[model samples]
Target: MRNKGPKIIILTASYGNGHLQVANSLYQECIRRGYDNVKICNLYTESHPFISEVTEKLYSKSFTYGKQFYKLFYYGTDFIQNKKMLRWYYQYGFKRLTSLIETEEPDILINTFPINAVPEFRRRTGIVIPTFNIITDYCLHSLWLHDDIDKYYVASNELKAKIHSRGVTESKVVVSGIPIRPSFSQSLDKSMLFDKYQISPKKDLILLIAGAHGVLKNIKETCETLLLKTDHQLAVVCGKNHSLRNEMAQLENKYRDRLHCFGYLERIDELYRIASVMVTKPGGITLTEATATGTPLILYMPVPGQEKENARFFSEKGAALTAKNQEELLNSIDSLLKSKQKQLSLQLSIKKLYLPSSQEMIMTDILKESEKISRMKNHSTIKSQKKKLGS
Candidate 1:
């Protein structure tokens, strides 16, 4: 039997993990709330695997070789959102996306990725499914905008105002914060974390996060610096980068007493709770999760596009500090570890960056929208029947 509850389709991409992370957070919360018809579609990978593969490689390589080109592409496209020209993109996944929609009969489509196709399709095809775009970063891009989109969910009030300035009505925008998993909002036992990871409570814990399907640029050097320069214990979570994981394992053995290395983890909330500070690139989801845990951050060399923007947003808000290079990153971490007052101040600022339960609040808003859309649909159906009877 099919679930008669609200049917939701969350559209996301895995170019990096941030977009998919938000989708997963919302999907998990939906299931936990007993909404059985919620499904996630990795729209790009599902629709055009070849393009997805090529672009993903370019995205990874952009960190090393093509950052200038990447910056140009980002700012160039970001500055001009050609809705007319986006018709080129609107057709890329049209068949697969429409087929999924037809099969699932979703009441609403939520985008964690800036997939403007749904809105473009709506404009062209006259379908009126309520669509919400969750801007997965602290910044706004014109690509995330469309008149057909019913609502906009944003990471910050600054982002919300930015969108508003771009002609999206203030009423249509919600400052929901970035949707991190709710587990991060609660406290975990530091003693248990230390025992499980076999680390000492005597040393401050520095966490290095190499994101899913990504390698830290100059990771070996970064790890070596932390070990050699400070009395702190280091935990590196190299997510899904098997080669980096293997490398970190070798380093772990060399510094067996102080270095702890891990591969991808299903639940990282405990590690977040136990960390004195996080040293990572400024990915939106990683930053959001860190803030939710109230962990002080030393953002390491944020890349030019969204990474730089995210770092700027947090740094401006006094929630986190940014480091320009390995030396700077080490210095920031050492200073944070040495100064108890600074750590407390940073933690307090980070805490203010997050809402209490972002996932729950977002889910609640989605359901409320779902109910409103259902009522509008029902009223339309009854009106159509009445009109037919009079005719």
Candidate 2:
């Protein structure tokens, strides 16, 4: 049975945790479904480490220091697909991806991150392998578009329409909510989570995530404001940010009874399950995870480009609240905490945004497309042999 499964190659980049996290979700689903041949390629890092390293650093800083330039770059390239100069970016990991496809001969390729190389390679090489893009965000960007992409798994109908407006056919889009860990979709023992983390079930839990790189700004002030003004416990996740983790240790000691801090949690969904409110920068995967768990989100100070758009999407949809500064954030949190109806309203709104069992849906769709491509190739092969025999 495993031998019959189509081999999968998921292309992702490590600019931020969102892309790789989506890749991991799909990879795990493939394994669960007995597709043991699935592979995740960190195409950027594997192909050009130096460039990837440079870009990741630049991107991490983009939210804080370089956001204006980032906004321009993100919007400026909205139609780069039609321009001849876009060929330069098409070469980012083009050669390496080509080489890998030749060596692996994968049945299909999935892009968890935007890499122009996929479409460019397919169009240039005329390879017929099924390719799909999992857009791990609420809004659309041109970087994710290419006609050669066989299909797109998008977060919302709005995003699907955006793709349609970009001249991609309506059939090419599926409004599959962004893939997150399956645990989010499963039942969690709330009591077990409380006891395991030594959390006080008595007080409301305010979960603040700084993302994988600790990119959320003003976390210390945000946490302090919640602690001083509210009767809530704090659970701060300072992911991969060692300095922030160190800073949090001091805060943890000061508010030892009410505050807990962690780094790079293996079971983040557990935190999501027990959280009363989630305050963090709006990355699509994180927001999607909160949406899945029905956790109320307060997206704090999203910068320009996708983060802002993601926040805007959820806010406009009434799934979350947007806060522009410390004052606005605390005010939003205060309202949610004090008003049970407000909390319930946000929870209900987020439930509307959830596409049930997102990981399963995306995985099933990928396999379906792969099977179609395999059949097409087999049919073409048979026709070619018949023609030779007739000749």
Per-residue lDDT of 192-307 in model 2, one digit per residue for the tens? 99999999898899999999999889998878877887779999999999999998888889999999999999889999988889999999988898888899999988988889
Model 1 worst lDDT window (10 residues): 81-90
* TM-score on alpha carbons, each prediction: 0.95, 0.95
Clashes (N, CA, C under 3 Å) per candidate: 0, 0
Full-model lDDT for every candidate: 0.85, 0.89
Model 1 alpha-carbon drift over 4 Å, by segment: 377-391
Q: What is the model-wide C-alpha lDDT for candidate 1?
A: 0.85
RMSD of each: 1.8, 1.9
lDDT of 2 at 173: 94
Backbone-clash count (model 2):
0
* Full-model lDDT, candidate 2: 0.89
